[model samples]
Structures are given as structure tokens and as C-alpha cells.
Target: MEDKRNIQIIEWEHLDKKKFYVFGVAMTMMIRVSVYPFTLIRTRLQVQKGKSLYHGTFDAFIKILRADGVTGLYRGFLVNTFTLISGQCYVTTYELTRKFVADYSQSNTVKSLVAGGSASLVAQSITVPIDVVSQHLMMQRKGERMGRFQVRGSPEGRGVVAFGQTKDIIRQILRADGLRGFYRGYVASLLTYIPNSAVWWPFYHFYAEQISYLCPTECPHIVFQAVSGPLAAATASVLTNPMDVIRTRVQVEGKSSIILTFRQLMAEEGPWGLMKGLSARIISATPSSIVIVVGYESLKKLSLRPELVDSRHCYQRFTDCYKRLYQLQPEMTQRIYDKFITQLQTSVREEISEIKAEGNLEAVLNALDKIVEDRKDQEEPAWRPSGNPEADLRSALVPYFRQQRDALQRHVRKQEAENRRLAEAVVAGRQQVQELQRRGQARQQAWQALHREQKELVAVLGEPE
Candidate 1:
């Protein structure tokens, strides 16, 4: 009876594992569909620099909506969705292949690396054309000045002739350059996506294991999973960001060949040109990748076991608990979970304040402010060009210390001259006073002598001292 029960348990585990994959596939598809707008916006924002599109993510979205309406945001979504679905095929196949490799391999790390790299290569090769097209489609729009019917990449017509719509642009490409034009950046796409995607899962698993070991067994599963995904995604992003930048540029431009495009960018600005939007890419990719993987993993787990969801649990389920297999409203579940999390965060801040004494809190806040100010100063660029309007205005109004030094020198010279002049005037006035006194004395002496002469003459005739 005991032996039979153990066999049944093992069988049940196998069944659950199989069921989980099926559930995971559906959930991942839904998540990707939901986030397509974000993905599209992020890609476009990364590609276009010096244009209004480069302003920032939010601004780009707003512009797209205002210029093209709701449809503009999801411009290439059909291509994107199809490509994503195709890519997932590779992912699924790669997972199976990786499992086989891992099972047969002696070393876990080697197995992971090989499995990841091989899977990426295979998947990317299969989807490169689709990827390129999707990228271009996302970037395509009627240039803001162009009318709705104006096609981008239209034929060389007369001066200032209006362009056509996106579909028209597609038709033009087909007419002018054929299928090859639509798949222009296929090689670049493959080169970028394969290695980047390949390294991600391996690194993710490795870090996740490391974090799990560091954590106590009782530590929350969600915490480690959440932390590991971000760390792994960040590491992968930094390593592969240059490739992503190139891919985005190639896709956006719709060049005829990868080699020509590469040469063009290199000739224009050297190798650094390929990394134009690297900062924004990293900023967007790292966090988004983390959130995506973490969300996917958590959802995947729940879908495997719908019964694990418990609504009664205060913080764990209330805040973090997402429904596993609710057919009715998966998105609604996510919304509820997010709201609960917001509330919990608010409560945590309030609780911290309640626990800490007000006196000590003020000191902590001061320290925090100083730290924030230091970070802000570090983040700000050391210099902005004087040609910039803001910089020009600021420069004109605020005298630099160097200018202040020159002004001070001129002031000192003027002050010294005034002091010398005043000193000379004082000396001249004193000399005049002395001269007058001397003259008066001499005059008095003369008067005295005359008087004496008179006295002497008189003395001979009667004068006393």
C-alpha cells in the first residue's frame, strides 16, 4: 500500500509539471499582449534621437496618440504579436533542449550556458525577419508634418510632395525594394537578440539559486524571486545594451543591408554611434525585464496551482496574492493586487512614523535630504553648452568668479587712484596753510622790527622795554 501511494504521488507530480507548462504558455501570451503598447513605445523611443521622439518615453507616447490617435500606439502590434508568438516557440523548444542537455551534462553551469546560448541562436535565426519588420512597424508613423495619407519612404517625387500612410509606405517598399527591403535589418536583429536572450535565463537561474542559498529557508519565495530577476536582468542589460542599440537603429532606418548600415553609422561617428540610445535602453530594459520575468514566473507558478491563492491571508495574499487560473478576469486580479500593494506601502510608511520618535525622525530626514542632494548633483552633467537658451540666459546674468576677479582688479585700481589723488590734495592744502603761517610770522617780525626801530629812536628820546 505504501509503495503504491509513493508511485501515485510521483505520477501526480509529473502530471502537475506538464499542466504547469501549458498554463504558463497561455499566461505569458496574455502578459505580452497586455504590455505590447509599452514595448512599442520603448522601442521607438530608443531608436529616434534628435527628433521629438527622443524627448522621453511619456512625451513620445503622448505625441503618438495626438498625432495618430489610439491606433498609432499599437502601430506594429500585429507583427509584434505574431513575432512574439513565433519566438515563444523557440523558447519552449529551447527549454526542452536545455532540460535534455542539463540531464545529460556533468557540470550544471556548463549545461546552463550551452543550453541558453544554443537556444538563443536557434530562436533568433528563426524569427530575425519578423523581429526586424516588427521593429520597423513600431517606428513607422506619418512624420508629424505629413498628412494622414502621406507615406513614409515614398518614391522620389517633386519638391515637398506629401508622403503617404504606413500601409502606403509598406506598399511602396514592396513595389520599390520587394521582400528584401522589409527584412533589411534581419542580420543585425539576429546578431543582437540571440546572445542577449541566451545569457538571460542562465544568469537568472544562477543568481536565483545564489540568493535562495543566502536566504533562510523560511524566507519568502516572492522576495528572492523578485530580487534575483532584477539583478539578473540588470547584468544582462549592461552586457548586451550596445547590440540592442544597433538592432534598434537598423530596424528603424530600414536600410537595404546590415553591412551598408554598419558602414554608414561607423563612417558617420565611429563605433560609438551604434550606442546612441544605450542610456535610455538600459534604463527601460533593466527594470522592465525584471518586472516582466518576475511577473511571468509568479504567474507561471500560480497557473500551475490555482488552489494556492488564498484571499483571507492579510498581507501575503491581499497585497501579493494573484489569482492563478481565473478565466473571468486575470487583469482585474492584477489591478486588485497592485492596489493592495499601494495601500500596504502607505501603511508601512505610516507605521514607521508611528514607531519612531519625532525628534529622531527630523535628524534622519535631514540626513536623507543631504544624501538626495548629493546624488542629484552627481547625476546632473558637469556642463551644458552655452548655446543652449537656458545656459545662455544663466551665463549672461550670473558673473563667473573669473569675471568677478577681473572686476575686483579694476575696482582696486580706481580706489587706489582716488586714494592717491586725495592724499596729494591733502598734502597741497597743508603746504598752503604752512606757507600762509610762515608769511604771517614774517610780516609780524617785520612789524616788530619797525616798532623796535621806532622804540630805539624813541629810547634815545625815552622808550622802555
Candidate 2:
């Protein structure tokens, strides 16, 4: 429903600062020339009854030529030329939509379906009436023939004898059925085209993505771009041919309604009637798809070279700068290392005083632990300087780190010595106290023995004990 394809086309055309419409329109029309004759023949066959005006594609071709001459094959040329407005609109819209969402969409399939359906929705609304007129004109015989239905717009009574020019058809259609008549098969058209576009885009995108693995370096890959179009078109055409037949029936005046048409086509011509002009449609779609896509992409790429070149050049310059930085001389790298070490020394020297004042030798030890923990996690040898500036810087830093390590070890040793002396004194005092207790206990024991002897002696005298 958001059929915003035109937005992207307008943007893309503006990107190159040139008009893409002219080239796009021309390429599309030219390719259409090859397929138009087939299309006309197919349309004529679709509009007729069970083998009435023509039996099949071969018969249609012969009859048109015999009745209308060389020009008979191009009956709808003028109307189709007018119809190109819608065709171009569809193409532009699709391009714009695809371009608009290219960056955000992860799946090519979804993008394709969305873009295709959206563009068709808009373009079909504008062009179905034109399609009506063209098909009418296409189904018409030449001035010389006599057919069962004496329709207007043709010289003989056999052709679309309702009107002459494009305006005449419009006027006549308006006179007969008014506005609604212009959109006679609106629902059928939507059903036919929406799914057709959705199917076409997904198939196109799927094949394009698969093909892209082969076009790594090119922007509008010539062969890949060209081949991808037809493959995608052919696939979509086959799948949607039945809907197309139904749509054609519903649109052409005097044909049955959609439900009745399907039944009639199936009953009269079999299921094959639903695919009446499949080959012709395929032929019509493929080259036109190719031409439109190739021309659009080619123009886009051609205009983008300068910007791409500039970007690459800027990237190269950045790379060069990095290379020079990495190639700095050993002396310069050593100066850098010295400067770094001086900063570290200053910071640590300031923190050392606070640590010492707080009597937190553990803090210094923790800092040393942290420094060791900061070692690189990778197994690669550090700096790897075989004339590498980074390696040279690492080499210069090694001596400073060793000195710091020695200083921290010295501090740890001092703390350990102080701790050892305190432990010795504590042990000495404990020993002295134990000796005193031992002497006291011995004296008490002696006194108690003497008392017992006396008590025994005095037991006879028992009182003082």
C-alpha cells in the first residue's frame, strides 16, 4: 500500500545529477518492440471465445497478418505507447522502493515482494483503463475483416470498432459506461498484478542475490544484471499466468465475469485456457525487464565512479598515515616510552608517601600485584619489535618496570624484617613470663611439702594445722 517506489527513483535519478527517465523510457520501449507483436497476438487470443477468432498463438499470428497486414501485429502500438507512461511509472516506482529500503531490509525476498506489489498497486490504478483501451485495440482486426462481433474503433466491423484514436476510445467508453467503465476489471487487475509483482520481485531478488556471489567487483555487473532480469521475469510470468488470464477476461468487454469466466475458460478450453498466452507474456516480459533493469543500473554505476574513487583515495591516505605511525624510528619510540615512564613514576611517587604514612605496606604490594595483573592476555610476544616501533617502546619500558619491581621487593623485605623482629620480641617475653611462673610453682610446692611434714609432726598436736 505504501507504493513509494517513485520516491526512490526520483532520488536515484537525482544522485547522478542527470535524468534517468529518458534513457529508461527509451530502453524500455525499444525492448518492448520485440515483444509487442507477441503481446498483441496473445491479447487477441485471450479476448476471443473458444477457438472462434483464432485457435492458438500460431493461428492468431497468421490471421492478424492476413487480415491487417504487417502493421496488424502492432495494433496496440499507439495505446501501448501511451500505456508506457504507466509502465515507466511502474518501473520507476519499483526502482525507488527497492533503493529506499535496500539498507534496512535483511531479506531480498521481502524487499522484492514489497517493492513489486507497491509499484503495481499505484501504476495499475492509473494504467488499467489504458490497458483496457489497448487490449480493445489489440483485439481488434484490421480494416478489411469481418468478424462475429461488430465492435467499434476499427475500420472493418471485426476489430475493436468502437473508436478510432486514443481520445475517441476514452470518449466512447465515457459515453457508454462512464467513470466506472474505465476501471471495469479493477479487482481482477489488482489480484492479477499485485501477486504478479510480488512473485516477480522475490524471484528476481532471489536469483540476483545468488548471482551476486559471482559479481564481486563490479557495480552494475553487465552480464549478471542482464541475465538476472529475464530469469526472474520468466519465473514470475509462469506463476501469475492464470491470474493474468482471469484479469484479461474481466477487463475485455463482452467477456464473462471473473467467476463465470474461470468456469467458462475451464469448461470450454480446459485448465489450459487459464494459461492461454503464457509464452507470449513471458516473451513480452523478459527482455523488457532486462532492458529496464540494465539501463537503470548502468546509468547509476556510470555516474557513481568519481565519488567511489574519492572515497577509496581517502581511505588509502588514512592507511598511509597509520603505516607511517607504525614505522616511527626506535629513538622516537624510546622517547615516547621515557615520557610514559616519567608520568607513571611521578604518580606512584606521590601515592607512596600516603601509603607509607598510613602504614599500609599491603597497599604497595597490591599495587604491584595489579601491575603484574595488567599483563596482556594474548599469547603473542609483546611489541614484536624487529625494528618495530612498538617493540622498541616495549624494550625501553622493560628496564623501568624491572626497577619498579626491585623497589617494591625492597619495601616488602623491609616490612618482613620488621615483622620478624616483632615476632622475636613477643616470643622472648612469653618465655620470660613462663620461666617466672615455673619458679613460683616450684617454691609453692616446696612450701606445701614442708607444711605437710609439720602437720604430720603436729598431728599429734593438731591445732595449728
Candidate 3:
């Protein structure tokens, strides 16, 4: 009891609500970006279910590059950024509320706890629409038959999708439900966020306090701050997993409520449906949050006086990072595409080899022709003449008849062999042409995807002005 009181007293003295919020949000963004690839894998796997979309993380990633050729993995980033901003606002509000409560109330810890809980509720309200958009965008498959065009290519912008892209999806929702369509899962989102974030932040603070008790006395408050943010994020992720699954389906499919989604999951996949992607979410969320927090905190610390760091400098740094990443993206995508194509080619070549080895009739005829040709040089004339000139002529004439018969037989066999070979060659040539056409189509699709991706990247980087 005494120790608890002492820890509370220390917490009251040491905690800075504003700094923690900024630190936490910064960390969140950093972690989110770093693990963006993993999150993408998880989303694809979830959408694919039984399909050959991807086998596992690595296999799916390889397949994405091979099938859609690289840009396919990051199709909805624009909407994602918008969604992330919504998430950040939630955290920011939570911190501000905590600070307000702490300042107004003598019991800082209790007020902070209340503030955190309420903030989650508010943030959920704001974030659900964006979440709806993001999930709808994520669940799409290559060539899944959306609207009219049947989009194909990469998440960067091709493969197989319904005609309506992200904007189209939004329009459909609006057409169906007006503004309300964007908030289809509002109730479920609130329910999930309130308990999830409320539990997460307080639990994180408690854990950090405990860790601090065990640490050396000389360390700064920043270390504890860093440790607490990740612990909070991870704890929230695991505890809220069922809700997340519910949330994802609700947002993407735009079903009724969380309960309906849950009921559907239970009916289709039993109770495990609620945990459909817990492993992936946990794997992606924890470390990703940690990285985000650590990097953000470090940057915040280094950039501590905004006046000195300057908004211009921050923008410049971000621009440089974006530029470098954008430049490398093509090379990275190409490497992945090349690797998958090589695998697919190997598969195709093996199939062709098997067909040819099955003793194709053409092959057999060609072998027979070779055998006959070898015997041609060794044989003497079929007819010969000797003694009297007239007798020799008659005898030679007899051999000529025999030779004609042999020549006729050989000619018939040769014609048959030539015909068979020609047929085989024709089939092989047709296959090659078809394969080339497919490759050409894929390349054209890839070029368009690359162009669109570049445009988006430029937009995000804000183009020097």
C-alpha cells in the first residue's frame, strides 16, 4: 500500500501529458510506416482466405510482385494516410483531455484515466468513417469484379479489382446511405475504441511505472516514456483483437452492427472467426508500434525546440526521405517482379518439357527418318546388269523396278513425318505467341501502375513548393 502511494506520487510529479501525447503519436506514425509492408501482407491474407492470393507472408509478397508486378501491395495509401490522420487525432485528443483533467483535478492519475477513456470514445466517432474507407480499399482482390472495368494489376493500381476504385467505393456508399454510409460501423467502432484505448493507455502507464521501479535511478524520464508507449500499444492490440476482426469486417463489408458481424463470423467460421487474423495483427502491431514510438520520440527529442528545428527543416527532411524511398521503389518492385516471373517461367517450362517427353508422335517419326537415312549410303543399286548388253539392260531394268518401289515407300514415310513435325511446330509456336501476348499485356499494365504510383508519391511529397 505504501509502495503504491509512493509510485502514484512519483507519477504525479514526473508525467507531462503534452509531451507523452506528442511522443506517443510520433512513435505510432514511425512504427506504422516501418511495418507498413507487414500490415499490407496481413490485409491481403485476410481478404484472400482460401484463394491462392498468397501462401504465407513471404509467399504472398512474392506472388504479389509476380502477379501484379510490385505496385499491387500499396494501392490504398492515400486513403490510408487520411485514416492515419484520424487515428492520430484520437490520440491527440486523449492527451489533451488527460492534461485538462490533471490540471483541474487534484487527483491527477484518476483524472488522467478518465480523460483517456473519454478520449477513446470521441476518437472512435471521428475515425470510423476513415476506417470504413481504408478497409473497403484493403479487401479488394485483383480482378474481383467491382464496377464495370474490372481493374487488374497491383495495389499500386492493378491486377483484379471491381470497376469502382476507392473514390468509386465512396460514391457508392454515399449513393446508398448518403453521409451515413461512411459511418456504417460507428457503434462497433466506439465500443471497441473506448474499452481498447482506455485500457491500453492506463495499463501502459502502470507497466512503465513498474519498470521504472526496477531500473537504475540515473535514467531520464524519456526512457520510461519510450518504454511505456510500446507496452501500451501491444497490450491494446492483443486485448482488442476480437474487436478488431469485428471492426475490420464491419468496416469493409458495411454490414449492420458489430454484433451482426460477430454473429456472421460465428456462423461461418465458429468462434475462431473472431480471431481470424490475431496472429498477424499481433505480429504486425507490437513491433510496429514500438518502432514508431522509438523513432518518433528520438526525432522529437532531437527536434525539441520547434523554433530551432523549424517547420521548414522538418518538411525538408521528410521530403528527402520520401524522395529517396520513392526512387528506390521502382528498383525494389522490379527485383520482386523478376523473381516471381523467374519462378512462373520455371513452372511453365517444366510443363512443356513433360509434354514433349511423352513421346510425341512427331518425335517418333523424326527418329524413324534418321534411321532410314543412315542406311541409304551403304546399299548397292537394287538393279544390276552383266554379260550381254541386252541381257544387262533387262537385268538392270528389274533392279530399277525394285528401286522404284523402295523409293515410293520412303517417300510416303517421309511426307508423313514432315507433316507431323509441322503440326507439332505449329502448336508450340502458337503457345509461344500466346505467352508473349500475356507478357506484353502485363508490361503495359506495369507501366501504367508505375506512372500512377509516381503521381501519388509526388502529391504526398508536395513537390518542392
Candidate 4:
């Protein structure tokens, strides 16, 4: 099989925009639903004062389950789901920005960082209002009899708000803070998520490139993404946890100033307070990153134009030709001939017709016959050619085959030399290990002899005289 790493990246220009958007939205929704409970848990953990209601993510899960049932975990999910609109905007902006930046910079890391930050800036406009409302809903407690869930900055007095009452939450925010209530944590959101996005993408690409280099050549693309996505997200989440804590507090508690929130949180809960929801955030982000990265890549692959897909397959065929050259399999040779003829027919139908009309077809056939006759005695044939254009073309391609054969032979020789060098190094390493073991044995024997002599000297000196 061809190494998929060699396949070209499916850029935004190559995608069917309509299909990409549709699939992207659907995938985003599905992933959001799957990881939403973690978001709710994280928000609850961040807003609660001094672990009053829930100690950590697992404890939060169990307590919420026991108190309010499964429905408790999905609180505010409906409002949060609206962020899929911003998710689409985020992707669109990221791709466009990355493409635009490509003309100026050659570095993938710089491109990703710029694109991610730009996307986050655009997305936060749509996301912050939703976050404000959903986080309010996230703080709502249904089963207050079990334990009062204390939120530090909650605008809704000390009373418990009913679950799924999005309208009431909106009304309360409007009546209390007016239109500005919807954007309570906008700055904090930008601070938290912009850097989060900016850091996440570059790290993701960097880790993926490193992993791809370290892994076997045949490793699948999806596996590389799965391993790299979570690692990048976890790193980003840890770095931005403090900002995230501040953002959640501002949105849920209706805090006015980011500076005030930070100072108060530190004064009340100390430095560790900034990491209140770190675990929940990491857990939530891991699968979310994996799904988003894998789904985005898959969407790009599935939405590629027909010609691009064909070109990709052609590239794979060219790479596979090296291996097939070594085996000289008749079936593989036939497939290659068929593929070549198909490409020729597709690409040069008009030229072929022009040749036939100009009465040059016979001359071309005679030239092909002459080439075949000249090569007839060169070597033993792998397969007899049927009388067809494909067969004739195959027989005429001896020079190309010879070139490929020479390159393959060189590669094999280089690999063999590397193997020999590695074998010699292994033998030398084993000899060094043996020498160390002998020295260790000698030291052990000397230490044992010295201990015995000391014991005799002590016994003789202490004889009851």
C-alpha cells in the first residue's frame, strides 16, 4: 500500500463547499451533543464557590445524577448547541485566513496560529451571547432539596431556577442587565478561547508531524489525528484553564470586570482556583478535538472534486509502480496498462481524432511496430502482449521501466548498507555491556573480601581479654 502521508492535503479550494458545510455542521452537532455533559460539568465546577456542591468532575457527575437524574447532566445543552453556527463560521474563517496567509509565510505553524486566532475572534461574536445564556442555565439547580448548588456570581438571587427554562433565564438577564447581559463575559471569552485556538492548531499540526515521522510509514491518517488531537487540546486546555475559569465566572455570575474576577477568585480560592475546572475541560476537549479534527479531514476527503480524486489515485499508482517493478506481476502490469490507456483516452481524445483525420495513424502504428521489433531480443518477456493500444503502449515504455528499475536498485542497496551498519553497532553495544558486567563482578568480589577481613579484625580485637 502507498504511504498516505505522501498524498496531498485536501485544501479548501479542492473541496465542494456545499458538501463541506453540510457535513461539517452535522458533525459539529453530533460531537457537541456527545461532549456537552463535560462542558456543563466544567462550568459548574468553575462557578461553584469552594467546592460547595461538587468536589470534582466525577463527584459532580454522581451528585448531579443522584440529585436531578440523567437530565441534570444535559442542562443548558439546547442553548449551547446553537454554537454550531459559530463553529461553521470558525472553520470557514480558519481556512480562508490560512489560504490568505500562505502567500506571505511559508511556515505551517505560523499559518495555523494566525488562522486559528482569526477564526476564534470571528466565532466569539456569535458564541459569547450563547455562552452567557447557556452557562446561566448550566448553573440552574432542579433538585435543591439534596444540596443547594451555590454559584458565586449568579444573578438569580439564592433561589433555584428550573431546568430547561431558557426563556426565564433570558427574561431575568434582560430585566436585570438589559441587552448587555447577553455579552456579560465577551472579553473574557475572547481572552480564553482566542489563545486556546491559536495555541491548539499549531500544537496539533506540530505533534501530528512529529508523530507521523516517528510512526511506521504505513500508519493510517486517522490514527495519527486521534493521537495528536487530544494531546494538543490537553495542552491548550491546561494553559488557558485560568482564563476559562474567569470566563465561566463572568458569564454565569454576571461579573462586570475580568480583572475584578481574577483578583476576587485569587483572594477567595487562592492560585489553585484558576484550575477549578481543568480536569473537566481536558476530558471534554479530548474527544471533541478528536472528533473535530477527524471529521473535518474526512469531510474534506469526501467532498473533493472528481478530478482531484482521480489525480490522487494516479499519484498512488505512480508510487505503487516501484513495488510492482520488483515483483513483475502480470496482473499488476495489466492494471497499469489499463490505467494508462484510460488516462490517455481521457486526456487526448481530440488529439487522437486529429491524428486519425490527418492520416498519421498508420505511420504511428509502424513506428510502434519498429520499436517492438528492436526490443524483441533484449530480454525474456514477463507477459505476451495482446494486439491492443494498451499492450503496444506498454511495450513502447521500456525506457521508463529501466529508469524506475535503476532507482529501485539504488534504494535497496542503501537500505542494505544501513542494515549492516545497525548490525555492527548492536554487536559493539553487546560487548560494552559484557565488559561492564565483568567490572561490576570484580567490584562486588573485592567488597565482600574487605568485609570479611574487617569482621576478623574486629573479632580478634574484642576477644574478652
Using lDDT as the measure, the top candidate is: 4
What is the Cα-based lDDT of residue 83 in candidate 4? 91
lDDT (10s digit) by residue, model 4, range 1-465: 456454344568888888888888888888888788889899888988897888899999998788667777887787888998999899899989989997897566888899899999999999998988887777767523221123332244323344436776777788888999899888888999999999998889888889989988778888888999999999999999999999888877778999999999999999999999899999989988898678777788888876777665654444344443424543344445456657777867887788899999999889878888888887533334453444454564665588789999999999999999999999999999999999999999999999999999999999997
For residues 215-309, what per-residue lDDT tens digits would candidate 2 score against the true structure?
55344455665777889888878888888888887777544378887887788889878878877787778777786567666655444435453
Q: Give the CA lDDT, 0 to 100, for residue 164 in model 1.
A: 32
- Model 1 lDDT tens row, 1-465: 011001000111222455555665676566556566667676775565434445666777687778667767666566556655555565466556656774576444565567666767666666666665556566656543221123453254211112234456566557756787666566666677667766776787777778877877567666666777767766776777666666666656655566676676677657665655544455545554655456554544454333433322332322122222122443333444446457667997996687484557767778768777777858443333443544443443255445778899999999999999999999999999999999999999999999999988977877455
Identify the runs in model 3 with alpha carbons over 4 angstroms from their true place.
Answer: 1-31, 44-62, 103-112, 145-164, 216-228, 291-465
What ranking emerges by TM-score with the best candidate at the front?
4, 2, 3, 1
Q: Candidate 2 at 27: error in angstroms?
A: 1.7
Which scores better on TM-score, 2 or 4?
4
Listed in order, each prediction's TM-score against the native is 0.51, 0.57, 0.52, 0.66
Q: Model 2 off-target regions past 4 Å?
A: 1-14, 99-104, 143-168, 209-220, 254-256, 302-465
Pairs clashing within candidate 1: 149-164, 149-165, 150-163, 150-164, 150-165, 151-163, 151-164
> For candidate 4, which ten residues in a row score worst on lDDT?
145-154
lDDT of 2: 0.68
Question: How many collisions between residues are there in candidate 2?
Answer: 12
Score candidate 1 by lDDT. Answer: 0.58
Candidate 3 lDDT tens digits, 133-252:
656665555656321112234454455433347767777778767898788778777776677756765776687779778767666655666677767777886677777767666666
Higher-TM-score candidate among 1 and 3?
3
Instruction: Score each candidate by Cα lDDT.
Output: 0.58, 0.68, 0.60, 0.79
